[model samples]
Target: MKVRATAKRVAFGLCVFCLLVYLVFPFGWALVSSFKTNAELFATPARFWPAHPTLEHYRHVLANDDFLRAALNSVFVACSVTLVSLAIGALSAFALGRYRFRGRSLVLYVVLSMTLFPQIAVLGALFQLVNALGLYNRLPALTLTYLVFTLPFTVWVLTGFLEAVPIEIEEAAIMDGASPLQLFAKIMLPLAAPGMVTTGLLSFIAAWNELLFALSFMQTPDKRTVTYAILSFSATTSSAFEVPWGQMMAASVLVTTPLVVLALIFQRRIIAGLTAGAVKG
Candidate 1:
């Protein structure tokens, strides 16, 4: 039995290691490439580490005004989407979780089903709406479009978490003359903090990385997201023939590092939030 257990542990460890390598390889390669000079990058045999590392690519990217502006644009759009999703999702989740209403199950199913549609499925309809509202080429257009995807997901996840909250607490609050809004503000929001952080961070990352909607809605050069900024390297340069792989990699690393940091900081909360919804006491 001891021999069998040891073999099982070893097999599990190997499987975990393989999964880690698969997930980390692309980001690791991007990080490695960010430090290398253009000459060393495409050299024969393709060395993993640069012989002489330099920070020129990072410096160039930072110095570019359009890049900085695009980063700001992305930040604005993502934060708006996250904050709106959370506020609206929390209220909807509270209602659906705590209140019994007609077609409640159907409502939950509809919200869940919204996630099933690919972004492309809604892009055309959204485009016509944006143009009709005269929001074309504006930052708000991106924020509005992103909410369609993020809000439903937020509502769905938070509903499960809110459902897991103890009903007695809410009842006690009501007995003490706490209004529904007061109970939600004072009692439920705090308990849902972990779930909020999880969903908010996920929503932010989605908005930050989204290129299709960004490309479709925003026409102005200054209104693009950071991911689009990476692509714009070719367009802004004096020579169209020149490819700035090193700089582009640096930008990718810059864009991706914050998300990594956020995940690391909130990984425990994310785990707790996700698992908290899976089980009900």
Candidate 2:
């Protein structure tokens, strides 16, 4: 029995090691390849390590005006979407979670339905609407489009967290002459902070990494987000289609760094928020 258990433990550890390698290998390769010259990258032996690592790709990416502009565009659009979605979602969540109005469940179902809809399904209609609003090629267009996804998700998650908050606390605040606004701002919002952070982080990440809408709506070069900018490298004048793999990898690392740092910093909050309503006290 002890021999069998030891074998099982060994098998489990091997499985975990394989999973980690599967997940980490691509990013690890990208990190390594980012520093390799084209000649070294295309070498016959397939060098795991560059003969001579270089910082030129990173430097080039950092100095490029378009890359910098695209980074700023991503930041602006993502931040806007997160803030707007959270503000509106919080109110909608409070209403849905707290109130027992007509069609309340229906409303939640509708919101969930919106979230589940494929972006491709709404692409044509959204494009037309953006053009009608004269927001085409604009950063605000991305922000507005992002709301279609982020707001629904935020509302649903926050609603769950809000529902978990003790009703007794709300009643006490109301009895103490707390108006609806005071109750929400002071009591409910504080209690649901973990959920807000988690939802907001998710929303921000989605908006930051969104590619389809960013590609479809935005036409101006400078206004494009980092995701779209990555593809821009594919169309260099050096050749009809010569992708700068090194620079692309370097840019990818830069683009991914912020998200990694964000998750690392708020990982605890994310876990706490996800588990907040799982067990009722």
How high is the CA lDDT of each candidate model?
0.93, 0.92
Colliding residue pairs in candidate 2:
none
Candidate 1 residue-wise lDDT at 220: 79
How good is model 2 by TM-score?
0.95
Top candidate on TM-score is 1
Q: List the residue pairs that clash in candidate 1.
A: none
Q: Which stretches in model 1 have alpha-carbon errors above 4 Å? A: none
Per-residue lDDT of model 1, residues 1-281, tens digit only: 99999999999999999999999999999999999998998899999899999999999999999899999999999999999999999999999989999999999999999989999999999999999999999999999999888999999989999999998999999999999999999999999999999899999999999999988998777888898889889887767888899999999999999999999999998888788768666
Clashes of each: 0, 0
Please provide, for model 2 over 198-229, each residue's C-alpha lDDT reduced to its tens digit, 9 standing for 90 to 100: 99999999999999999999878889999998
Candidate 1 achieves a global lDDT of 0.93
Residue ranges of candidate 2 with Cα displaced over 4 Å: none
Model 2 alpha-carbon miss at residue 23, Å: 2.0
Q: Give me candidate 1's TM-score against the actual structure.
A: 0.98
